[model samples]
Target: MPTFKKNQSSTPKINKDNLNMAADAFKESLVNIRNSKTLHYIQRQRKKISENRSASEKYTEFVKKGQDKPRLRDADAPKTLQERGSETVNRFVKYVKHHRKPRDERAVRHINPKHLLWVLGGICLVLIILSGVNERFRAPFRDAASIVVVPIQKGINSIGLWLSDRIEAGKTLAQLEEDNKKLKEQVENLTMTVTSLRQKELELNRLQELFQISEQYTEYDMVAAHVIAKDSNKWFSTFTIDKGTNQGILKDMNVIASGGLVGIVIDAGPNYSTVRSIIDDESYVSSQFEDTSELCMLKGSLTLMEQNLLEFTDVSADVMISLNSALITSHVSSTYLPGILIGYVVDYQLDANDLTQSGHIKPVVDFADLQEVLIITKLKETSD
Candidate 1:
């Protein structure tokens, strides 16, 4: 109890955990040392020493370490480290460039912007005064400047002129297009007006002809009517008129145009009537020569009508009828009024019996283009 012996068996055993804790403590001590100002200063002094070494010394040291060959040195032969470092530092200082200190921001802030502007204005005024006072002083510079700038100015001017011309051309094209449109409109309007006027003129002339026919037949009560419809193949054969019994038109009423007899009203309705023209194959008229009073029966044929002719027969051989003699409807006719124009004699020949004659007559009416006609209200058989 008086002497205490070391307790070896009580000593703790070292494991991976204890070793790890000791390594952590060592890493923390290293971090503390790296962050200390004394370590920072030592690192800076080492960097300075390395920078002060001559390139020749660095190359020699690299060669001593069994590295690659070094570049040749252009300085004096190798010297001590202190002498070489001093020489290297002195060379660096000889090439070192000293720069002026930057202007203090506080001093710059004290300067007024207006004072700088005034100074610049004074310089510009002096230049202007000098230029005015001595033309020769600026002439050389002006000429030199023009030598370089004249071509550029000319190019700019030409570009401007080209652009202006293009603009004007575009405007002119637009104007021309607008004018062309207006001209087209005017031409169309004129064409329409001309067509309308021509139609009215034709109508007026037709009415005038009808009026003259009415005057010629003063004793007959006549009604003017226009042809409404006809068969295209039989233009002069049969047609409908725009008048009927409502306007006093009756069957067998004589229809006449400007020239002479046209047809007889074969059918009548309340508003329209149908007429069988003298050119129809079924038409037969008692016709007599105006000069000789010779009576003949006129018959229609499609072939004869194509030649503007009608067949005439039953004329007595004693009756003297010559070519171009006018023929009219005879008083013996039941459907046609007396003295109505029928046709003119064309060809004549004696019949096989030798007692009568037959011939062809050219009708007075132009049956192809009949537009309007007059219907005689009085029936040939019923009229007093």
Candidate 2:
């Protein structure tokens, strides 16, 4: 028979929360007999009590006095903020420690039973292969077979590393390509800008030629006007002379430069008059070479642009021209007066296809930007 140990009343312990936990533990243990390690002894004692009818009568009275209602968990359980926080912290710590996210392979494999089986089968096959190769893997057997393949697992690892590096290299290559493209575009833009500047330089040189021509003929009643606006093409080399009718300019008046005949005044408006430049294909003048004193037709065309070009052409191919030969207007010129400067003939073609030599004449005027100009008032002389 088992002896029951009674609780000692001397041990005093009470904290409301501790009491609840302890009471719950006690009730749980008592209600569940399977939880008791000493169940055999408890049963023997119960059997003894049943055998003795008087003992049974005493046990019944004792059981009645001692038995109380088991503790039940409350539906509205009260917990402190600290307890809730502690629980949350514990849960988070556990979650972090054992947080194994589903691998991509695992998710796919689980979804497909065939894939899972295939992978397992492959694993088994590899194990069998390793087992079969184990005997040959030993040194003596490997030496006998002399064709020892080291079974390069490192090769696979190297391939993985190489692939990763290549990916990084590809990104670097893309960046370089972008940089190269930007640099190329910038170079093209710079080239275009340089070309435009060169054209403007040539124009300025031509306008400067006119200025030099003016210095030679100081006796003429001439005033300079800038060519304000004009067409860039050969068909319309006309522009507005800044010095207009307000400056006593008239219609049917001949406009000239110290260089040569510029054009006739097409229309003399209030403040301005349009004059065609000699560069226009329609312009033609009689010219004489100062060195040879030979008369020839001087024509203008826009074809001569190689390196910083001009627009003047020679009508007589036989007209002797050396470097720095001065070309001036003859007295026979219909529209322009005699002794006006055209330009210096630096290069010329002695032989021609259209009875005229095509050549370069460096003009005295800077045509790109002209601040000062001389218009021959004598060309527009009024009747007294």
Candidate 3:
């Protein structure tokens, strides 16, 4: 009994006044520490922690307001930093419990192992039958499959074809452009060759005509010249020759082409000459019929030149001038030589005065296409 005596300790009784005094003393001590420079950093850190806690609490409150069921963290008041990890674990557990689904007893009852086996057997049998079917029996099934698969195949094929065609078209277009350039160059070269050949042919023809003219006028000396330029305003009315005074060509020299008289050289220089053609408004030639003694004058007319005709005036009324009669330069001419072919008569009529007759004559010289000429060195006054 003497060994069983327990040591008794006195317990201090805490009233409301004592609790208040203790709390006041603790608060005063905390205030003093907060004001101390040594605890400044600790105070700042504690303030930052308090700000972070307020922000986190506000975010949690906002989340709770938005949700139909408040989260466990949001249901409770703000927690200390030490309790955050446990709160997160509790929230995760709650989330898992909330989303978990209970097994449906009705669904389990609906499924039968025997029924599943039968369905599996039926599927296997169908697969085996399909695999064993003959080609003829499988035709309908293949056709049905093709109805869906063929269109997709065709769409892919069409896209591929379209791409191929575009690629081919691009290549073809480039090739065509290159070919066109080559063809154009070839055409230009051929055109130049053809032009050169045509010029040579024309020169040969002129030479032949000059030989004939020489034979016809054996008494007269002639110099061959090419018509280099013509007046644009009055085409064949005035033209320049290549031959000049150096070639014995002089002023008033009779210029003739293949057919007959072409023009009279009005201006002659050392290396060039200008000829006034018969079609010029200022030109006048003494002409007459080859068979008849009837005399007339051939003159240029702008209005009649378009029809390749010249005006024939001063013909005797009694003279029976018929169509197609050969007209030539008369000996009575001052500038032109005698018997030179002028033109053939086309039509005749009485002149405006009725005292003389006039007619239309188509010149023998092709003035429209005059290219070369023969210059008769001997003038009519100087000729024998």
Backbone clashes in model 1, listed as residue pairs: none
- Give the winner by lDDT: 1 or 2: 1
Q: Give candidate 2 regions above 4 Å deviation.
A: 1-218, 232-235, 252-264, 305-319, 352-358, 380-384
The residue-by-residue lDDT of candidate 1 on 166-186, one tens digit each, is: 887777777989999999999
The number of clashing residue pairs in each candidate reads 0, 20, 0
User: Which parts of model 1 have CA positions greater than 4 angstroms off?
Assistant: 1-218, 382-384
Clashes of 1: 0
Residue-level lDDT tens digits of model 2 in 1-384: 223333477665443444445534544555568745456555445455455344435545556765764444365333898877887798899887555543432465457788778999998897679757763333343333222322232344356557867887777777989989999999999999999999997886698796764543446676666554455564566766555656887554665554544556654554555676555566676777778877766665655422324544555766556778877777666656677777777676754475776566765544444333456666623344
TM-score of 2: 0.37
TM agreement with the true structure for every prediction? 0.43, 0.37, 0.43
Which consecutive 10 residues in model 1 have the weakest lDDT in total? 97-106
Q: Per-residue lDDT of 1-384 in model 3, one digit per residue for the tens?
A: 112222357655544444445544544566667456546655455465455344345446556766676576567865787688787789899998655643442377678999999999998898678757743444454456445644464456457667867887777777999999999999999999999999997896799798765544446788998666678885448977666766888888888888688889987765567899898888899988998957899998777777878889999887899899899988788888888888888999987786889988888888898867899899777446
Which numbered prediction scores highest in lDDT against the true structure? 1
